[model samples]
Target: MGPKIKQINRRLNELATEWNSFDLGPSRRETHSFVNSSDVIGRDKDKENIIDHLKEPSEDGNIPVIPIVGIGGLGKTTLVQLVYNDDRITELFPLKLWICVSEDFDLPRLLKLMILSVNKEENCDGLTVESLQTCLRSLLNDKKFLLVLDDVWNENRARWIELRDLLRSMDGLSQRRSL
Candidate 1:
């Protein structure tokens, strides 16, 4: 039989009031449908390589910064995503972050996304980009993280570099997983 549990020890029933509340959004299960792809077309060798990389976070005495570069519609995103979600990878790096820099790249939006992805239990509402940057710095300052920036396309590479800098400044055994 299961072990018996303990009891509560509260005296007064103090009720708390909500202030500037945010809606308890739907779970990922309900919001975004998981695209089943176990039977998805092949990439066995690539998957193996990613697993190996995760095993050895360093290459040539440096933390490997792998950039899966290729032109559009070449399955770059798909390949990266597959590796990102692979069971072996999921086991290796406990912390993972994925941000999509689509055709239209925006700083505030990207910051909000990074905050939400890492600090799932916290709210990012009303936080300015600068504030977000500060908070991101604090959150990632000493945490080993894997950040993925996907689908980048812009005439000016400056925008991409700006975001990359912020990511690079993050702490912990962090590495950027781009495609």
Candidate 2:
């Protein structure tokens, strides 16, 4: 592995070990079997706004990218999860995908994840970027898909453009919505 990758792996291992050693007390939050819309308190307005945006028609013939930007621990993920599992959302789009794009913004990995999400049996290993893009384009052709890229941390505009362009290449892919 490269030096940067090795360093990151080592840091991740250390963090994992440190996290496993932590034991403060019992959990304060109540665990639920499922999070209904009612479970998300004080976010009705946010939910409505997002749902409205989802229902809005795109005038530019391009996928609408709605970014929910907030600092950590502000229930950003919770809000998204609620929207993702919402009944209206589930019924609106037939194909739904949730991808958590954390610190590492590897394009190939993200593409592979999308492909695997849609076609679970496909072997994505040893596939080049062109092939992966082709697979994604083929899978999403003439289909309305809802893709949620959560926890995105990458700031490289070029990388984002490359990924976005690949997604746009799919037939009828960029004419709908994204989050």
Candidate 3:
């Protein structure tokens, strides 16, 4: 690995160790909450640019992948959440899916998540990767979809290519697809 990658891995390991050692009250339970749109401050320009990009049509008629790259805690997730929840964006893309891809980038897991996100009632147990991909394709057929893979840390080119190829197969069914 390169020095930068090694540094990142080391820092991540350190953080994991620190997190594991942190103490919470015995009765405490972690609660997850989203930042309300009203409470999000100082990201109007970033939201606008992303929204504008989403509104623009690709000349090649292919799906566009817009990446929001930044270091941790820089509000990249918040910005995308704002854009994802925007009225115009919702209207433009009828189907929206958000998958949190933090550190674990297993293709089968991702496919299952996508299927579940499309329809919460889906039974994805024991399904192979090909079957999962087929189910996802069916759910996305004839729809304009926005898929947000948040906190993606996988950098394997081969794995990415495999996932991209699977997603690319859905292009014919999707009017617009975002990642």
Kindly list the per-residue Cα lDDT of model 1 for residues 1-179, writing each as its tens digit.
Answer: 22322222121222112321444543221111123457558777886776676666443433356677777677666777777777776666566778776656778887988887789875778988789999888877766666676665555778767876776666543343333
Q: What TM-score goes with each of the models?
A: 0.66, 0.78, 0.79
Report the lDDT of model 1 for residue 37: 56
What's the count of clashing pairs in each model shown? 2, 0, 0
Residue-level lDDT tens digits of model 3 in 1-179: 69999999999999888877885423322211145999989999999989988887767745578988978789888888888888898899888988877777789998998899899999999999989999998988767888888878889989988987777777553456565
Per TM-score, the best of the predicted structures is: 3
The residue-level lDDT of candidate 2 at 154 comes to 78
Off by over 4 Å in 3: 1-34, 171-174
Order of candidate numbers by TM-score, starting with the best: 3, 2, 1
Candidate 2's residue-wise lDDT over 61-169, tens digit each? Answer: 5668899998988987788778777888877777888787876788999899889889999999999988998888888899887888887777999999898787776
- lDDT of all predictions: 0.64, 0.80, 0.80
Better of 1 and 3 by TM-score: 3
Cand. 3 Cα-lDDT: 0.80
RMSD of 3: 8.4
TM-score of candidate 3 to 2 decimals: 0.79
